[model samples]
Target: MRTVFKNFLVLAVMLGTFTSFANEMLEVTPTFNYVTKGNHISVSDAFGEVIYSGEINYSGNLTTLFDFTQLKNGKYDVEVTNGFRIDISTIEVKNNIVFVTDANRKTIFKPVVRNENNSVLISKLALDGEKMDVELFYEGELIYTETIDGEDVLNRVYKLDKTLKGSYTTVIKSNDRVFVKNFRI
Candidate 1:
């Protein structure tokens, strides 16, 4: 019995160490639209000047809302660090659209839509040589779905239906990551 207890204690300590290490690898989501407010992440401008920094208040699951309303249209570096592990991303705001990328310089799926000339423009970026599954829903009905086999840092643009009104939801599945964005037109 004593030997079994000792082995159990060692196993518990090993599991605890692994959990702590995993928690140190930071995961961040930078907000682009005005749908949500309040900042739960840190951001720095291209010049490495800290623009926003604060601690995120935890409620239940990990969810963060970043306010980018005050920032002018420009490129910024956003970083999230826990202990010694750090993850940095670059974000660009143009017109009213925002683009975000990961540390490996791969664009993360954060699509934006805009109305122009009686048409809706939808744009997003994907990594080279990756297969992306895109599903777009208008209101609660699925309007479009496609699987794109990307080639060389793709900048994908889809001219949505001009008459498309009401709520729009886009879901992108790439590798093991899933990104969802919603907009009202």
Candidate 2:
């Protein structure tokens, strides 16, 4: 009986992984971003092969790698293109600025809100390339995790609950050097 239960559990887990992503690594082709009208959200290519789809902070000027000025707010679909499987594990918003990081892909993303002009800016960093295909899904369809931090720089993914927060982790490389921002706060 225990053996049977174990097999079922393992099968279930495999199915879950398959259904969640079509490929192993997050992938996107001809990257794109968008924003909705009423809600004021924007999604764009922030991190490596990742999308920054959410609200648009137009109170001030914003900057993103791709063309997000035409971005709108709505149910943004962050798809992993090029057969790369990517899942946004965590996202945090502060002072109208959205800070998102997919440690699952070893990347950090920051999307600032620009409500007045109805737009948003995207910034990010990604290292390590597992060379896996990627996919995308609707919200609440993926699972993320929260992690604890230490005294020094915290490495690894985590989750933040009960605060309109999203958290998770991903695999990355160490030898690769990609600088998103080098400013001191």
Candidate 3:
């Protein structure tokens, strides 16, 4: 009985290893598109400079592929935005070949930041329970900063000081993505 149990355990381990390898081999090449209007795709280098930009003019289900083989070997980001959530795929190019993994892909829910009268309203649909950091800057100085966590939906209202009339900047960060919005008081 002891020998039989050991044989069964070895077979189980081998099957598990094969399944993991199969999943990795089945990963598809990343494609950029969405079923809507204003679909924009941009590929940026490691230094945050856009190298290639394209737009899908028509509406509905469509896809546009970016040739990664044309780029030099380095790390890059492929971003697709459609006035809503942003999908970011981080790829590494080596020897003129692009390598992508599922672990480096993420989707960021864009927060709605707008000024209503003297108050700034910020709202986001964080269904994935992603943490967010919000910072308020006045005249290029950090005034207020907060870390939001453990919520499916994030909402906040900040009443700007009317007396200090200057430029205001709101920065929201989530899942390694930073969004900045500038306004005047």
Candidate 4:
């Protein structure tokens, strides 16, 4: 029995290490269409609105099915939309990209990390004639910054602490137009 127990423990540890090693980073298209027409458009695309996971009765982050299991450490095609929020570290490699969402947040963002620090710092640039106030959220904490001109778009910076599993969301507002983008794990 003692030998069996020791073997089981060894197997568990070995399996864990193997899984970790096999784990790869996912480069996702955080946004399919940033500014399609109106509010919730990008959000719909990001979460697959009423398409896969069920449109009417099920309002779940439809893209939840497309969980990040699609890519390895290579370059994966990503789509940057109006409200691009992706916390790149916590990706679940399924058949597709299922964002690893915050337990408390209805929304999720997979922010990409440049270094081992796992700190995802994003840069924002606007387009031709759009005025937007981009707001960033990390694990329920709100950090906001505004951008007036699309050409003169400013950058907003925020960090996700370790204890909180680096989930993010973006809110872009222009007068009566508002776009909300979130991640789903």
Candidate 5:
């Protein structure tokens, strides 16, 4: 009876440890839909090749840097998974901008600027209750700034100044995070 009780106690402890590890939630911050450096993350290309992987070292806000500055622009799958739960984000990097979405192409935040009929069109979409500050800088000078309020889904389109002939930088701030993209006219 003593041996049986000891075995049972050991089993209970093992099960408890397994359960605790399995229940750990994997959180990707600055938006789970998009991944940059400083997030505990693993990135794979479309061919299932692991391009980048890193573990979070900091305690607060999941700030761990994973460098992708030398990578070529393309679609990649980012995985932030614990032992039990797996979260994947599909992202495309183009023109210094990272466009991120879920498996179903549901974007968390999407921003696009394109030339339309000799004019530049700037469009952005954000999730519900998300506040965004969009700023356009021309030649290092602030050209325009727009603050978007939180709504169920926020969408905005602005016509950019086509006459500003040079490289422009768009800075987007949302949810206490900032994203910068540079484009040329």
Candidate 6:
């Protein structure tokens, strides 16, 4: 009788363990819907073509659904952009099946560019130790280049030459992304 009781207890524990593991695995299953704290979201292809774009006008945990079935069998990127950072996730589609996981997500900080009068101020939060490249161009000619890193926040200010000025362009590059700002002095 004791042997039978022990076997039943062991079987019950095994079943409970299996159930817990299965529940954890299903937590990340792709339901094509999720709650986001972002304002704008977009889905793009591998060739840098935007497939779908939407804006979240309301606040709070709003659930959004993206239909991946309309897409072809390939890999795609979904980007959610707030004011300061962009969250990216790569989803794969195979044989009309969509796969997504929280492990395949990344965030990129965006540079803030402001042009006031003749002074240009650029600021970025350096989180992932990625080097930022600041380039200055005058009349389509690259004149200055500066690479910045090793700080919590990267801030740069350039006061343009008030005399020699027709058109000026400031290009900020970081984390394989580029931002261009143009101004006239």
TM-score for each candidate, following the candidate numbering: 0.38, 0.17, 0.60, 0.28, 0.41, 0.64
What's the number of clashes in each of the models?
Answer: 0, 47, 0, 28, 2, 0
Error of 3 at 48 (Å): 9.5
Tens-place lDDT digits, model 6, residues 63-157: 22555766898888888787888878888888877877567688888888887777888889877788889999999999789988777688888
Best by TM-score: 6
Better of 1 and 2 by TM-score: 1
lDDT of 1 at 180: 76
Q: Lowest summed lDDT over 10 consecutive residues: which window, candidate 2? A: 111-120
Candidate maximizing lDDT: 3
- Compose the digit string of candidate 5's lDDT tens values, residues 1-185: 99999999999999999999999998646555433334456788979899877775543422224444445788887766443234566777776566665553322444555655435465555554677888878899997898878654444555666676788787877655576778777
- Of 1 and 6, the candidate ahead on lDDT is 6
lDDT value for candidate 2?
0.32
lDDT per residue (tens digit) for residues 1-185 in model 3:
99999999999999999999888856453344333456787889999999988885666433334557778989888787868688888878899776774577777789999987888899988878988999999999999999999888889999988798889999999877788999997
Q: How far is 125's C-alpha from truth in model 1 (Å)?
A: 4.0
Q: What is the C-alpha lDDT of each candidate?
A: 0.61, 0.32, 0.81, 0.44, 0.64, 0.79
Candidate 6: residue 154 lDDT (0-100)? 88
The sequence of per-residue lDDT tens digits that candidate 4 reaches over residues 89-177 is 22233454444433322222222322225343444434334566666676666855656664444444445456655566767665334
Q: Write the per-residue lDDT of candidate 1 for residues 17-110, one digit (tens) a residue.
A: 9999988967654442212222245688878799888765543222225556457899887755443223456778777666664543323444
How many angstroms is residue 61 displaced in model 6 relative to the true structure, after the best TM-score fit? 7.7
Candidate 3: worst-modelled 10 consecutive residues by lDDT: 27-36
**Models ranked on lDDT:** 3, 6, 5, 1, 4, 2
- Cα error of candidate 6 at position 179, Å: 0.8
Clashing pairs in 1: none
Off by over 4 Å in 5: 1-107
